[model samples]
Target: MIIQRLDELAEVIEVPLATLNQHYLDTNFKLKVPVHFARQIEKGNLNDPLLRQILPSIDEAKSVKGFSQDPVGDLNANPIDSLLHKYQGRALLITSPQCDIHCRYCFRRHFPYEQAKKRHWQTALEHLASDNSIHEIILSGGDPLTLSETGLLELLRQLEQIPHIETLRIHSRTPVVAPERALKLDWLAALKASRFNVVLVVHCNHPNELSDETKTLFEQYRRADVTLLNQSVLLKGINDSAPILKALSKKLFSQGILPYYCHLLDRVEGASHFEVDDTPAWQIFETLRKELPGYLVPKLVREIAGEPYKTPIIKTL
Candidate 1:
């Protein structure tokens, strides 16, 4: 279902109120956890200091400026329900407007999910089906995996019915935030069973997010013949350092996940604090090039509105 409030999600996931309370107290109640991860809550307390470092506080959300509700020009697009066709050939379907964790650097934190749902989604699908140029469909949003197994399966079935669509890509952070959710073998099997070539693009910012459990899930995806790619956002105090980036890239490769795109922060209203200027970002890319092989290095890029492709961050100096 649609989870709007944190409490509603906690109850559905069967997470104990005390456990959530402890996490809140650890993060000083300012840090908000995403609904998907909150659903799989078990036991134990997170290291308060470490939790504070990753989780964003409600107060800190107020401090940052320029992070708008509609970052990446999503609102300007002629959205048909959850589908956004800002770029040609690929359609971004906001299958689920929920995420497993409320990342401090999320550009869509203030997005109007309600408006997204009100638009006629089926019209967008029909548009994709009729277009000969549109070959790929990108499942995005808070996170596509937040949608239930049945929901995702139904969506996939419908997508596969279209004649022009050949590639189905899913961009999600759920596998990192809630590893257990990714362990759903039945869902993996169903995804593999689809007619389209399935690709899973995951977002993993820090090496710490890649745990053994995540590794096992990757192995499952591999066995299901799903091509796995990773994209990370450069965040200050999170993963902007060269060493951290290298380690994260190396770890992802070891798990058969390719290093895809390292995106510059989308200058949303609340995320200015995480934005690393182009100068330093290019330097980090240079450092990575020196340390890692060509294939291992993720392309440093920025998403410009109306552009057909991501703009590569080039060093002119």
Candidate 2:
């Protein structure tokens, strides 16, 4: 079940209306939270890290400089109706425009997703076939796994026909936030048998997001020869410190997922409040380096609008 109202959300967690109403922001983005994910929250605690990421905030009304609707230039890079050709050798397919939950800090929160339809996939796939340089296709969205089993399989079949595409990378938050929606058996079978190297990158922010269900689902993916990786946005107060990040990395590793990237919050309008300054961000990274082995340390990076690749934020302030 999805919760779209503050009252419904409050009822799920058993929080009083007065306390919940204080921080709620009724905006066009809307409140969208899955019941399973909502159950993870600590009831009555409005500051819960998971809750902070989704609950529409009054802070979003502030107009901050350097933050924009097209923060990473997604509109500028979009070459076709459903395709975003950003990094070389890899292109992103906007497989679906709907997500199970609406993260307030999402860089694509304001994206014009009306064109992300199955009808547009043919055009995007043709572009992929025409360019041999594009060897990998990242299935991203609001969340690609939101596609039905049939929809996903058919898309995979079409992608398999492209000889030059050697890798099928799926970047989704569904596996972490809504495991039931992502763990389709037919989808897993097709992925295991596919010719392309399959990599599933899940967006998981806090260690609290990991659970037995996620662990079991991840193991299933591992059994299917799918590489499991995770990427997190370094949100201020949510997970800016070394201890929290370290615990997150260890928990991810325990569930067969590697820490791929700890991204600096994209400078998207309304999300500026989540951004951690470079000096403090670098300091946290340095501390993480001391606390964990090299492999466990996620690369701290930021996606600049026109850059060829995600820029590593390694320089000390």
Candidate 3:
């Protein structure tokens, strides 16, 4: 459930709204919630002084230079309204344009969601069915889990019909933003019942986000027989340090989740504040290499437009 008002969420969770508001304010209005789980609570007003810290204001977005509406060549790859085929064996389908919470650093913040919504399962299925080499269908967007259970089930059913589509990967922040959404046993059952192999890619930036509730959600996915992976962004104030990254990876691994990708900030509008330079990113990665096992070291990657795969940041020592 998208709680637009903090009070409403407090009511549901039986916490005081003032307490939640104060938490945001006490943190200098910075995003205190983990990136993975921060999207569920809706801001009543973006201009609310306390809210503006985390929620991007229109003026702030406009002030940023060189931020394009289509940052990562989505326009070029979008063959259908909802489908984007850029990689060899994978096709990306934007299932929903609405997120439970909007992150200030979201790369697709300026994407024309209204236009994309017109392209639904029918349009996406046509694109997926037409390509024989497409072995994986990636569900991404405002967060695909925001879709109703029925909507997701319908999508899964359509995709299952494509024999060539062997894997279905859902990239979502729902488990982080709203643990309640992840607790939906029915949705997990539907995903497991589907014929396609399922993988859930979750986003987590800080260790604080991995509360007991979130860990339980990961276990729920594991029980449902879904492969779990985590992708984190290299953010300036949030998680640029080596210790933070190492701790986050350890916590995720303890929960049976693998650290997948550590992405460089996609130079999107309003998100320039979070960009960590390549040199610093590499230095941090080197530290992580020494501290954590090879498997726990997430590949440092940058998504260049029109590239078949993410470019790994190689360091020459």
The CA lDDT at 194 in model 2 is: 94
Steric collisions counted per model = 6, 0, 3
lDDT of 2 by residue, 100-129 (tens): 999999999999999778789999999999
Candidate 2 at 108: error in angstroms? 0.2
- Please, what are the lDDT tens digits per residue for candidate 3 over residues 1-317? 44445555445444466655654322111233333343322334332322332433333434577666577898889887788889999999988887766666778877877777834669779878888999999999878988888788778888888999999999998786677775767778987787878999998787766777888888889988999999988888778899999999999999889999999989886667678889999999999999899999999999999888999998854
TM-score of 3: 0.84
**Compared to the true structure, candidate 1 yields what TM-score?**
0.83
Q: Report the candidate with higher TM-score, 1 versus 3.
A: 3
lDDT of 1 by residue, 36-122 (tens): 444333323332322333444343446555556567787777557677887778888887766766676677767777665524557
Cα-based lDDT for every prediction: 0.74, 0.92, 0.76
Cα lDDT for residue 263, candidate 2: 91
Question: What's the lDDT for candidate 3?
Answer: 0.76
* TM-score to true structure, per model: 0.83, 0.98, 0.84
Give candidate 3's root-mean-square deviation (CA, Å): 5.5
Which is the leading candidate under lDDT? 2
Q: Give me the candidate number with maximum TM-score.
A: 2
